[model samples]
Target: MGRLALEVADIFRAHGPAWRQSQQGQLSLDQLKVMSAIEQCRSAALGGHVLCCEACAHTEIAYNSCRNRHCPKCQASAAQRWLEARQDDLVPVEYYHVVFTLPAPISAIAYYNKAVIYGLLFDVAAETLRTIAADPQHLGAQIGMTLVLHTWGSALTHHPHVHGIVPGGGLSPDGERWVACKPGFFLPVRVLSRLFRRRFLEEFDKLHCAGQLQFFGDYAALANTTAFADWLAPLRECDWVVYAKRPFAGPAAVLAYLSRYTHRVAISNRRLVAMDARGVTFRWKDYRAKGRTRYKTMTLSADEFMRRFLLHVLPSGFHRIRHYGLLANAGRRANLAKVRAVLHVAPAIDSTARDLEATVGALPPTFVCPKCGAAMIIIETFTGCRAIRAPPKPRGAP
Candidate 1:
């Protein structure tokens, strides 16, 4: 891909040091690491290779990628690899998109207790789906779903939510037959909304009782048990945002959708328009608006931009994408086999040969010549902080 006009890395490299020093003790280790990674990503600070084209003898330097999960530039390849692995998991069934969002009140405290609350969000949402689907009154089947966590809204606000991609149907209790939902509909949104709210709050309460929660700033008073309970009372009565979109057209469409969301960062470099004396300007969609009016641009000071970007740095080793119920990692293969059997559809094609080929160095080259479209073979490798020699001239060049 051609270089972008601006990037998060640019902002970090230009302003991160000053901003980071200003925050001092306020930033977490994980956040600091993220800033450093994005700043040094694809730069001479990380080691890289020199590539030369066989066709034209053209050459260029190819810097190494940080491969950090939080880095926007690195997730595209990661998402593609993840999608290739999941290609076999898709069955010939309608897939539904569902979103579960925490209310603003809980969202405020979630920053201080990210791991705890985010964990509850994933678990409670999955349990709510399984419980309701298994009820005879509903689908009466054990459904599977893939849930991906997103912690930022369009304006880079702290909004914690999970987007669930679920097959429109499930397997019956006996595993003898396929149980499909009514055409185009997955589950009752209101029902899912209520159950999700109650269950999440129940688990949230338990965490507080066990002293697993932390509060700071204005919420510091919530350390008292009575105050905490009182704080959570209103959330029970309020309607939590849980909604499901219509079914996807086909399994290919499902894969297309997953590609966009599965490994997404808070913001893509494409969204950034400019950075100057005014600040960082970026495009954002205002969902509350209608038609063309919804697309807009906003600017934030360098310090605020970095602060909002870092707001989404997840806890170390936390899995942002999760599979649950029928799609649970442990039994997903067997479950898919059973589902395909009941549907009388052929099973997914085995990719052992293709995988073996990739493992044995049959994969395509990582970089290619821009002028001739030929593979670019590495001629030299350099370590971090080391200078690379000048590129060789193309064939016939003086």
Candidate 2:
């Protein structure tokens, strides 16, 4: 802990109470819980583990992580574990990156109706992709996509967008053959944009009809259907933003990209430049600019910083990362095998054999004891407690 100069926890520990008091009635229970968890994470308040290197007898006390999904410090291990599990799921094919962004008009209403709107966002985006891909004039295949939702832009504003990683080819309609896309292209962006806009607005209208949407402050008038329709009409005339990037270099690069985005939090402590009376200064990318001007720092008041950070806490039980089509969790395993068979690729290799083959020539012994160069053992562990101080000493330590 001493090695790090700053942390999100430090901000919460210092200013959280005052922030909470200021917004007592407005803060959601989930946000309150997240603040408490981050403030207490890896500190004496959460207890810790007592580890001793068997070879060198080096003793260390390690505190517990809060494990809250929003905590930046906790995502590294989660990403690694998730990537390890997904490694075997990788097929030998080019993957495409597609993004679907919510329009500015909807983004405002979405702030107050996150659960309903975000769910529609995911469902509509999936439906749009699947429908377009299945068109005979296009790919004429049932492609798979793994979609992740990100609600913040580079400046940490509430910009809702979905990132989709799709396989370049897919199974045939009869499930009897593999259908490959053009060597470099996935689908027509203009077609995708039009369909996504129409579909999402259609779904948004349904939610509005059901009275699932709420409007407040400047948007209070949108609670009426006529006012809402007038607002949504502009979106129909303007183009929605849905575009795909070039195919990934290989199967490995897909996993590498997913790792960066899958378990990401709003912001990491590393980006924080300072948190003084002038407020918090941090780095951000200005997409509208070019070259050095594109990368810039932004400072927001401490109160404003915490408010924007909490803007992305997410609704309880909401699933931000989702799969659709062949990648749907229910059918992914069987579907992968079917695709491989049709493509005449070798059967899915078991994890053990793949690991051995991939690492047979790699370096070794990075975890040896620092003092004696011998391996160490994790002989014991202890769970956290609210008031606990230190972990239990190794069996017979003084």
TM, every model = 0.95, 0.91
Best-matching candidate per TM-score: 1
TM-score for candidate 2, residues paired by index? 0.91
Candidate 2 Cα outliers beyond 4 Å, as residue runs: 350-398
How far residue 141's Cα lies from its native spot in candidate 2, in Å, is 0.9
Reference-based lDDT, residue 32, model 2 = 95
Supply the global lDDT for candidate 2. 0.88
User: Every model's Cα RMSD, please?
Assistant: 8.0, 6.8
What is the C-alpha lDDT profile of model 1 across 185-296, one tens digit per residue?
Answer: 8899999999999999988999989999998999999999999989989999999999999899999999999999999999999999999999999999999999999999
Residues 1-398 of candidate 2: C-alpha lDDT, one tens digit per residue: 23357787888889999989989799999999899989988887777666667678876666788889999898988998888888877788889999999988789889899999999999988999999999999989998999999999987899999999999988899999988999889999999999999988888888889988889999999889998999888888998999999999999899989999999988988888888889888989899999999999999988888889999999889999999999999998899999888888888777766677557557454245656766555555676655648988998899
Of the candidates shown, which would achieve the greatest lDDT relative to the real structure? 1
Give lDDT per model, in order: 0.94, 0.88
Candidate 1 contains a number of clashing pairs equal to 0
